[model samples]
Target: MAEAAAKQRSPATPRPVRCIVKLGGAAITNKGELESIDERSLRSACAQLRQAMSGSGDAAPGKVMGMDWSRRPGDPADPAVDTDGFRGMAGLGIDTNFIVVHGAGSFGHFQASRSGVHKGGLHTPLVKAGFVATRISVTSLNQEVVRALAREGIPSIGLSPFACGWSTQQRKLVSANASQIIQSLHAGFVPVLHGDGVLDELLACTILSGDVIIRHLAQLLSPKYVVFLTDVQGVYDRPPTDSNAVLLREIEVDDNGGWSVVKPVLQGNKRGVETSVAAHDTTGGMETKILEAAAIARLGVDVYITKVGTDHSLRALKGDVDTSTDDWLGTVIRSAK
Candidate 1:
């Protein structure tokens, strides 16, 4: 009987994810303010997420219109959707096996930067204090995000990277328990993770950026695709603030993770595009985001970067946007031949 009980208690295998959506910190929070959330943008994002995840049978009022699930020619074959779990529900528009990751904008960045938490040296009183303060702030934001998703009738549970034993060595992630995330997916809950202060083998403690988290998750989960919802339309040839800055519609990434703009015929190194990081953002900002997106693309998973709360974001998340047309107003990073 004990053996039988043990067998019954065996962990279920994790389901393959349809996609992973990353909510940029700056898009959902007032980066200039201390711990201020952009309620309007957050609400809009949650609503669109509901629409994208809802099925045709759902009575939800703002169901997404004109979503085509069929893959386009030259596009990678869609990942197999699991048919025996929560995703197996009939009439579902898109597979329910997905993950949401968010950054720490005004929530924790100010405290972290002030305390120099990302610089390590936790043996110092300042670093230790900053670590604790940073966690408190970021986790507070996580709760708000979970509450917002819950309000939209989405089953979301906050998962902190620090709580999951995610640690780094010399600013590079070396250990993380992907099992926690997988188990959450297996149990039919959308795991909502956020950037947080984590232990570092060398530095003692450091800040793990959400962009890096997304890259690590993509490597472990191998989702069909990844979406980054940001404040801008997409990656640009120059700073978006510049009048002459042009949005690069599509970026082709080679196996080695090098990328180049395939649209509008841009010259010079796209990676060198000028971008401004927030004064309080300890993370590398746009440069890190693009680099991580390219890394994900190198793994054969397409990455979409678009403005949050836009139709393009919704379509990109649903994997039904027509990328060949000029109507697509986002940048798609895909593996080149």
Candidate 2:
């Protein structure tokens, strides 16, 4: 009977995606304010994304603002470049099949933290109320994001992890209906997922972070590249607020998943960078993002971390920016082996 049941189940393979873009909640929303979105930032990010995916015919040529727009030799032969039917990037004509995952930011964090939702134990009324409140806030933000994308003619569908049978055990995601996301991608619709409160076996309930979700999806989809849109320029040797902090351009991960900065080694204080998480944030913040990026890098996918609504970010999303060039103001994580 078990063999018959196994044979009855059909296998679903996800299509090859060109890129996965993670919109940091801090980048799109005002973290200092409760449930407030940075409208200007969100609109700009959506516009830039639209431009990157659909291409801009009027963009300046031959290295605009120190970015290398110069077409590489035999560009048409690149497997990543596809111009058959889909709208391609300007000058490059590259097709981007991408997904967007966003953080909860101020929307759900306040509720989750206040009620100790991350701590679990759904037996309490406060925890249950917090779960509902968190979902309502995050899903509202998701709707706003999807609407913004729609305004730019991008077909986007929001998938709530909590509503979609994503469950965790001991705060670790054990199962998710990834096929729904894959099917959405195969149908040419952008699947937008977010950090959410999910049912847990051991804890009863816990926060499933967007960073963790990105890492999970990357492992399953194996996209060519992943881009993290942050509020800052990129990963720095120390906290970016510090005057002596320096941006680390490239990080290489070994076969065993260990990583080291490969460009512009730090001159002093190599004791590792210190990151500060928001008081109300249930998630680990920037530190978690870096850890997830490293995990994705270990899977042989290049990851780019850059500020949203910037020229470099737009280029990175379009898959045209060369990471080796010093002009690109971002951190890229890649596999060493």
Candidate 3:
């Protein structure tokens, strides 16, 4: 009788499906390390995120910023903490449960590749150098993001991407104790995950890029939504550059569906990045993001790809939208029956 009473008296817990928002590197920061970071664009994204989190049924968004943290021996953190991180999202009646996962935009991506120190990927001898570069770069970004969140009364932490315990054997996460994520969610905490060189069972190498991380997370956390802020508004029928390119508002992920490979709309520092045109060099690009998102969407999660500048990001979270942009916001590749 006592046990039954306790069970009945227990408050019904709200099982909120997790939320995954993957901000592309090009969207958040400038391309090359030699180039400058875009403070204005970053601020815009932060503001919208803040607004969305304060939205109805949204509560405070668990925030995470993942990056490749690295630094030269005596480098100080980026002095100008702009309006990008979650802390910048505050004051809009939104408190981000912040999690940050950033990439190694300048640090390892260039150095390792150039040095050829890391012959291939994770197992490369230059891995130590790569990890060093990744750590410094990622760590710096983490601190700034954390500091911003902390100032806003939102607790934040810098967790390593590799430490998340995800395997790339089948190109998906096979093991991870969801308890940590569960606890964080219950407490309204945001866990951030970014791409890093991880041990891959199939390729016998290391895979880097936040794209992989987002997919693994979707499968594990079963988030309610996966928002990828692609460089463009959404997918286009033809190459966006092709004067006749039409923006595809929505897509159904059938075995054979509608999605064409157009020239990449996103551009890095034009004067830099030898691999700038190397489409497959990076993690999942627009196509991969679409396919991955579609697969997860099949699991009943709504996925959206929108320009970081538009209101679609906020509207999508609200669960209703009428996209009116021509640049393309995003396309939902619905799963095949």
**What overall lDDT goes with each candidate model?**
0.78, 0.77, 0.52
Q: Which residue runs of candidate 3 sit more than 4 Å off their true CA positions?
A: 1-14, 34-36, 56-107, 115-124, 147-154, 170-172, 201-205, 255-284, 323-329, 335-337
lDDT of 1 at 85: 43
- Note each model's CA RMSD in angstroms: 11.1, 10.4, 10.7
- TM-scores for the candidates: 0.82, 0.82, 0.66
C-alpha lDDT of candidate 1 relative to the true structure: 0.78
For residues 1-337, write the lDDT of model 2, one tens digit per residue. Answer: 2233233222865578888889899889998999999988888887777777766634643221111123445776433322332343344232436789999877999999889999999999999999999889999999888877765557778899987798999998877767788788877788999999999999999999888888888877778889998888888766777776778788777766566777665454232332232111122366677778989998888999888888888877877668657889988888877
| Candidate 3 lDDT, 129-187, residue by residue in tens | 66566546655555554444444334445555556554455344434334554466566
Q: How many backbone clashes does candidate 1 have?
A: 0
Q: Show pairs that collide, candidate 2.
A: none
Candidate 1 lDDT over residue span 117-140, tens digit each: 999999899989999999999999
In candidate 2, what residue range of length 10 has the lowest lDDT sum?
61-70
Off by over 4 Å in 2: 1-10, 56-96, 268-284
